[model samples]
Target: MAHFRQFAFKQFGYFDFYHNLPNQLAQQDYKSFVKIVFLKAGGHVVVDFQEYQLEQDALFFINAGQYYRFDTSCIGTLLYYNRDFYCVEIHDKEVACDGILFHNVYEIPVIFMEPATSDIMQGILREIKIELAQEDSGLEEMLRILLKQLIIRATRIWKHTHQVDNEDIRQEVEFSRTFSQLVEWHYTRFHTVAEYAELLHITPKALNKRITRYSQTTPNEVIKSRIMLEAKRLLAHTPLSVKEIGYKLGYDDSSYFIRLFTKQAGASPQFFRQQYQQA
Candidate 1:
């Protein structure tokens, strides 16, 4: 990590890495801290065995223990922090990225940016870079505030992009947001549209309509996607066998789980694991 970027350490375990990152990220031992990378210009990043090509400015919020390899041509800002310094979970209400961005393993690790938002993000990153440069005793609090603002802004963009209808953005945003939360909470035990609909205080029909409208996917798709995302993560990160992984995801019949995963990911669980491990 030290070889990858110029770093600054502030109060109480605060650490930030800002660099004009090269095309290929150097692989050292994996890290135990979370990473918030603000990428601009043009490049690619591979995270959790998935590759993303960034043609525009992007924000990548990655949790601790995830693996990432960046394109050598990548150029932008990178910030790293651990629970000891500042925990996003403790400040969830203030920053609000606990589910949607940071702790979310289902969502992609990239947020493609619009120009206006990109300008603001770039400005904020520049300010952070400048603030960390001097011997300012008050840098911690200022950086915390700035980091919170950045997370809120990034969450806004994330919700807007994932929302089906931006016309009544607020209401629909809440609807979709609550739906996602429900999925995260009960996805393991509850897998039906009607069950989730009941929890959301809406009809199954209304749930599907909102999900399809904003997410461009059916309720069943979201359920399956969440289940499959977890299954994939387990397969990639754990030594669990295919049958064992399936059972953990609540599949009584291992064959059914294998079929579902193959259909969605275009490969068998074992095959996907092999490919990922070899990568």
Candidate 2:
């Protein structure tokens, strides 16, 4: 039994409400929409080839343009929406989630919820489903409110978990978010810590210290990881040759790119592509 329901307005956007996770999610790519998944049970989600096992109640936030798939299906509630619908003309401001929840590359995107928090979030999801069940004129606005509520609560939870209470800590968080946004915008062009540090008006050493203080990896590692993730995605999904992929990723020297990718990924590009194809 597939428990999938959807509501869409051709002018606005589309929303999917899932009582149970569907396997089709593995096959379909929603490159233009952001996604939130609240899993009630055990499952696995793969984001950019990194697999996360969900042993308990958890929430996942996936930004648009990233390659993701449900490796194991579980009973869950999912919300998918693009910016055009959520940030329509009538809205004065877009949801604050674009930076913290969806685009913060330093933090792992999954939130493992306690039972109390899970119940609260589940209630919001229930209201969304209820709103979707109706076809009234106010349905779009009501659904928008519900979705914004969900994002706001999730952002609060994320801030609480990361302890962004103090001014110093908040400033650090802001730096990290800006760094992430910069990296997202320029990873294809700027591949060095010094480049990003210059953009942040800080030294590479200072940038690394700030990033490593809050996150697990160094600034250089984060940039490399983002580039390698894109390389892996293109290799697995596209028919581009190794040299073509390397050039696309701003690497003119194919041999150097191959060596760097092998060192970082522990396999040659061709081997990795073949493995994904066989799988």
Candidate 3:
């Protein structure tokens, strides 16, 4: 087995990446780490895979391990920092948010910060950049402070924009979040809606109905999607054989796995892996 090094933020490390992303919509894929885009000026940004849209003055968050594309011709500053950058010890419990706990594609939480809040965030980012560029010995201390400030700001913004107080939406979001977490933990073994329903303390029928109502998709579809996503990730990033990957994901029969992959991804596992490699 091969071990991958975990990503971490280090003291005295300068982390900064800025791109004036060109116009002309293009598809992009990410492997790990989330990105927070504060659209300074842009026509419209589309998260192709999710069918989510963001216009000017809207903030968007993308989780690691999801494939996405952006529209052509938008001018904005992109912040590409690892989640580890914000993991600092603080006295105030409220100063730290559980941003690092979420590591799934559907776990991405996005909120549009108000104009005043956005300006404040941009200013903090600017200060971080300035501090990173400096050669001072205490630069790491300054960067850590700035990163904590940014996380706190984001939490406040999310709290303000959160629409969960609407009971219907709240239930929907909670159910969806719980379902997602369950899938992440058990995708390799439990592949049935009834199994998940039992774990969630809901009837299978009720679970299906709630899933369909909230996501406009059946629980079975959601399960299959999660399975397929794991398959894709393994195929694209690891040197695992199709049979091995299928078996690892709970498909004992490789032929059945190929058929399922074809049904969900419109291609065979080998073909999909080859295509991804070629790209």
Using TM-score as the measure, the top candidate is 2
Overall lDDT per candidate, in order of appearance: 0.71, 0.77, 0.63
> lDDT tens string, model 1, 174-257?
566678778877888898999999998989999999877655678888889888877888998789989998888888899998
For each candidate in turn, give its C-alpha RMSD to the true structure in angstroms.
4.7, 3.4, 6.8
- Give stretches of model 3 more than 4 Å off: 1-14, 20-118, 127-165
- In model 1, the clashing pairs are 22-72, 23-71, 23-72, 23-73, 24-72, 164-213, 164-214
Residue by residue across 202-245, what tens digits does model 3's lDDT show?
99999988877745677788788889888887898789999999
| Candidate 3, run of 10 with poorest lDDT | 1-10
The residue-level lDDT of candidate 3 at 211 comes to: 75
As a whole number from 0 to 100, the lDDT of residue 157 in candidate 2 is: 81
Task: Count backbone overlaps in model 1.
Answer: 7
Which is better, 1 or 3, measured by TM-score? 1
lDDT of 1 at 5: 23
Candidate 2 local lDDT, 112-198, one digit each (tens): 888998999999988877776677888878877887887777777878887888988888888888898899889889999999999
After superposition, the stretches of candidate 1 with alpha carbons farther than 4 Å from their true spots are: 1-33, 48-50, 64-67, 82-95, 99-109, 113-119, 133-138, 155-167
- Give TM-scores for every candidate, taking all chains together and pairing residue i with residue i: 0.74, 0.86, 0.64
